[model samples]
Target chain A: MLVNQFLILGAVLFCIGVYGVLARKNAVMVLMSIELILNSVNINLLAFDLMNGGLEGSVFALYIIGIAAAEVGVGLAMVLLIYRNKKSIALDELSEMKG
Target chain B: MLASDIVVAQNVAFGIIAAVMVLFALRVVSSSNVVHAALSLVMVMAGAAALYILLAAEFVAVTQVLVYIGAVMVLFLFGVMLTRAKLGRDADLNNKNWAAGIPVALLLLGVMVYVLIDGLGDDKLDVTSGTAASTAAISDLIFSPYILPFWALSFVLLAAVIGAIVLARKD
Candidate 1:
């Protein structure tokens, strides 16, 4: 019962992340959305691990968290550095990378 | 059936939290204030942790709370506060924010929903997950088979910490 609950929650989080990634104009906000996406995946892993007769999901979640931490660190640093140089945190302004 | 009833109830609960998570995610993106976005992201993370708890993976749930709530969020907020990114800029809203990403997300969402609906009905495995067992098992795994990945991840974090410091320095 609870596992199902968690699965739905994870799915919901992923959708929200999708919205954030798609809708947000600020790069930092996009990063936050990415965090949401990652968290949803973590929730699923933990939930499924419990249901799968093993701790594989939880273990994977741990490593994912480590990766997420590093990602946030590097991402926020990049945003801050970019903000410093360009005085704008808008995704629209950071088109230099895409082009 | 009692099991069916329980499933229904839990599904309702998950639905509610999912709503909040998505709502906050929307706020995080649509709001002009970077701090507001960061705050919404907190809601998102906490909601995710709540789902973890529901899954009976108490250790992972607690770790989620500790890592994202305790550490990641603080780091994000500090960066936001320090940088003083634009709080409000209505000069334009037209950007490539959702241009190429919306359809992909929807496609993924459909896939996820399909998988969850199909995969989670029958319980072939028992969840013996709790603080003690999980902690012990996780530690054992890390010390034995997963040790390399653990250390590699730690080193990556260390590198990130160092890089962030260097990037933020007054140079």
Candidate 2:
């Protein structure tokens, strides 16, 4: 397949992720959107690596995966904490500090 | 099989997998149920892993499956369950301005696709090229000049663990 095909796929995924982040009211759903964006980025990285005949992109992608795991861990913990305090995980409902 | 035949097969596979991924990604965002979204995200991740394999990044593809599908999705499921979100369709799942999202997403997608094609349209993915980064080389890269970042990533994970425990703990 042409490198352009992968690029287009990644772009489409990223756009969908952006829509999710913008549209979702549930905090967990937003986090899932972020994960989708990260995955799209990984696709682009691997595609570029293949095109450039280098392994650096794959290594970078590995690091990105680790970072994403950490992000979800921390993010979910925060969501749970919010749920505990407010009994809800809706993003709009937690706007107490919107002064 | 002949080389051209293999390329044709890869193109077909890529088309099917990319379509599946896009569909599941839409489900992940549009679904009213958080659990359903998470489950569909798993399919999206799996499709990405398949794409990685097509890119000839075998080790990276394995890591993608192990880390994303196995660990990350499980973490999301745990979060969804522990949070006790309502399992059915949610009426208030989307924000009031959700309609505004469509044009913005389309604009971004259009810009990116244009840039990518204009910038790298001539370049082709060398599927029959050299092998992907070996585990040894990856480790060496991690341990050499990138060692500091590696340690920093560990610290980040450590911090996340501690922060999670502390934040989620009942007062």
Using DockQ, give the best candidate's number: 2
True-structure RMSD, every candidate = 3.2, 2.0
Show pairs that collide, candidate 1.
none
Question: Candidate 1 on B23-65: residue-level lDDT in tens?
Answer: 8876765766667677878887787777666566677778888
**Model 2: how far residue B99 lies from native, Å:** 0.9
Each candidate's clash count: 0, 0
lDDT (Cα, 0-100) at B20 in candidate 2: 100
Tens-place lDDT digits, model 1, residues A1-99? 546656766776677688777777666677888898888788778766766567777788989998998999989898898888988777766666785
lDDT of 2 by residue, A20-83 (tens): 9999988999999999999999999999888887778888898899999989998999999888
What tens-digit string does per-residue lDDT give for candidate 2 at B72-170? 999999999888988887788899999999999999998998898899876667676657667787788778978888889889989988987888788
**Candidate 1 docking classification:** medium
- In terms of lDDT, the best-performing candidate is 2
Each model's lDDT comes to: 0.74, 0.90
Error of 2 at A95 (Å): 1.9
